[model samples]
Target: MTHGRSSNILFIMCDQLRHDYLGCYGHPALKTPHIDSLAERGMRFDRAYVQSPVCGPSRMSTYTGRYPRSHGTTWNSFPLRVGEMGMGDHLRPLGVRTALCGKTHMVADRKGMERLGIAPSSPEGRLMAECGFELWDRLDGLHQRASGKQPTHYQARMQARGYRTDNPWEDYANAPLGDHGEALSPWHLSQAHRPARAAERDTETAYSTDRAIEFMEDAGDRPWCLHLSYIKPHWPYVAPAPYHRMYGARDVIPVVRSDMELRDPHPILREFHRNRVSQVFSRPEVRDRVIPVYMGLIKQIDDNIGRLLDYLRKSGQAQRTMIVFTSDHGDYLGDHWLGEKDMFHDCAVRVPLIVMDPSPAADATRGTVSDALVECIDLLPTFIEYYGGTVPTQIIEGKSLIGLLHRSRAKLREVAISEYDYSVRKARVGLEMPVADCRMQMVFDGRFKLVNVVGFRPMLFDLAEDPDELRDLGADPACREVIVRLTRALLDWALRHHCRVTVSDADLQDAIGGEARAGIYLGCWDQGDIDQIIRSGDSGY
Candidate 1:
């Protein structure tokens, strides 16, 4: 089937952004007019969850349309195995070109690539190619302390622009001025509140936005998918001069935590709180200082999104392109006494999902909001379906969102799941737990969220009552039925979707004709059946 000219996709992803930080998602002070514009003309999901709460695994799920366990890339820097079909693989056959302009956080499976004899210098061997995307202009945009190591592409560009420090990415882009006129490093937890020394145009967000525009302008008349991934609002928590001063202590929201939450917390939660990330965020003074900078970074991202949207409209691409704005995951920002994302709290797992389909068919549901339980993995299938491509259900586990986009009330899924494997971090932190015990999985069934750790007690929260997730109902005897129901649901989900990469029993039965096989074995039972089988054998059975 031929796809329409409006089948182009602009998949925008921001790092470590929360759902409540956007104006469209009901943020009171944050000005995201550009992102809000997308919501005004499209469908916004009120309850969207990532497949995982970390960058690498979450992005893997997005690209592959499968869970982390299914893809085998469970954490940051983990490689997606070679030969695994991704969005690009599925879309390219349907005449859509898939390209990435910015960060993918995809560590190529070096071993697999080598075993398959794929050259690293070849287009098919680069990180983009391995992940099923063509490399338009790759820039991960992270260059903190790469003194002796090879600098990132963004850092090289900074040097070419006359920012000539040993680590300009850290000094000019991430550091703030001190009282003595020195570069106060952002890595210092106390100095994370300072403004960045780099100019607004020189920031990573600006660079990524510019590159994305270049890709869009150069894409001529073809249905293309460009992943305009931006590495911002993630860490270094610093923004350029005006954006840094955009918010202050007055704008900071109060940290969400209580004494009751700390009391008899789960072992994993207790360990996380003791970690450096949680320890720094738990302090009142630190929260007061850092939250504002984090807010500033998000505002900068919003402004950049505005710039990109304006360009698309001016270029006449806005009417034909399907714009999807979302994040890999979210930051804790002192929520539930955590800083970086690791656990399964709403702050870390739930992200803003805004999809704007520009086709005339989608006009009826424009600006509508859906409360369906959506996951990040659903995007690939959605893109496939939008391009009029057949979704390879045997490989892609996620259901397409076409029904939801059309304003259908029929539910695509009843539960969303997220998993994290913290064994490496646990071992580094000297935690006295088994390697398998460091993992955790979360299952949310629209209302209740159940977090099951490998070797610890489960944690449950009734989102209807405790949206903050401060109260733990896992230990309550009255909520045992709820726990049992969700647990069984999660178990059934895992069992059904586990790594059965090949054809199933039903598929095999259908592939080889059911009655034909039986008739072939019945040698002397029926002369008529035997004759039919003998005749079919000669006709390429």
Candidate 2:
């Protein structure tokens, strides 16, 4: 928080939270006072994006400070390939203990670990197995009702509270009690509006907050980084007690969509429209009920965040910890006639980013809004710099934002990049794309947005003219130059991605003049020639 050598980091991430849903981002009605306070006391970025639009890939990029292509986990349930250094892998040896209290959506690369003979029971192997974090208490919370797996710890806790059922996660935590005393699934839009059967404190958001507090209390004075993540404001879309009824249909904003987007959509976009989530959310009748419940869950998170902020101040950790609040990716929620966040729409990739730096250098930029185009990977370098370490630019693909936070002259970036591989999705079949050809890449230069699919025509939009992204200029012959320009920008970014992570900038510099040092002189006619070459600092080493 101050200029401490080993400062703590509270990286708070929420699931499926949209950027425009927060009051700090100008949501007219949803009063996220706690999150808004972070913006009021810190630097808020107007254009922050994640590398991928789904949970696993986006978070993997967030943790590793690399692109999804480099991390090799492009979709949910895909294991981050072992040996990819994560936040903990980088910070732990530097005297910072990294821990997780909620979801990371990181599927373990157990087979890779096994091939390398890393025992699963070993401490190092455990960290590798969990995306490099010591689990304080983890709950992924996307439990399917028909999995037939053993009930989760949350379910066990529900039983402990006398709310026993076949699937307590769905029965009490995600379902609402009907008039006839039957538990109705929140999957039904009409039933989704009803309050969950579980008490407010027993909900997932509250539970994660409680566990995060426990982790803080147990951490003592040692410098630590706690990734406090939440699992609500996502699919099941149910809130407990009064929070469920916080807002009604009248409070919801006008849906930013039109019938025109459905006409002559891209082949990939058309397939997305066929998705059940997309179709269901496209209906106005469904949106009216589900959106309010979604709003309620966010309100609940805000309240719990308030609780955490208060505890931090009272416990005196507030001034010594860097608090970052952001979401992995924004939810589509039927915007652009799509659902479930695998697209390049701002509604899917853009996210709210607030950093509350307590150091005096950051005082000048406090409560300021930056319109710089930034990505999720930037946080790793920012954290590395805050802890007084040099950012290893070879593997790290993001520039540190510490200068911006400290009110230094900002270096503006031309474009922000987001990548997604859709080979694992059901849409691949609908689009008839080969597994290798299912990748989707987006390049946005604040106004012009370009999306390229491996086997199809690129989708382009001039957001300046159509801020809601209602027009597709990809097929317009008059806009061909714009498409070509953005396509070149995408190529430039791709060429810059760091793949040789094991190599360092220092290693590269040393290699430059190593020929003379090794006595393997190039174009040397005699020993004297080699000697003269070695004598000068400009020697071709």
The per-residue C-alpha lDDT of model 1 at residue 259 equals 86
Question: Among all windows of ten consecutive residues in candidate 2, which has the lowest summed lDDT?
Answer: 142-151
| Backbone atom clashes (below 3 Å) for every candidate | 0, 2
lDDT per residue (tens digit) for residues 1-541 in model 2:
2358547899999998999999999999999999999898899999999999999899999999999988889888899888898998887867788998889988888899889998877998889877888978778875434257676666667778898675666777788878777788677777887888888988889988998998899997778889998997888888898998999888788877878888888888888889888998888877888888889999999999999999999998898888999999988777887777878888999999999998889899889999989999999989888887778888888778898899785854789999998888788999888898899999999999999988889999888899998888889999899999999999988887468888887887767667666666788788888778878833563
The residue-by-residue lDDT of candidate 1 on 267-289, one tens digit each, is: 77887887788878888888777
Best-fitting candidate, scored by TM-score: 2
Which structure among the candidates has the greatest lDDT?
2
Where model 1 places Cα greater than 4 Å from the true spot, the runs are 1-3, 127-130, 143-153, 179-181, 427-431, 502-509, 512-541
lDDT of each candidate versus the true structure: 0.83, 0.86
Q: What are the clashing pairs of model 2?
A: 512-541, 513-541
**lDDT score of residue 159 within candidate 1:** 89
- Tell me the deviation in Å of residue 528 in model 1: 8.8
Q: Model 1: which ten-residue window has the lowest total lDDT?
A: 514-523
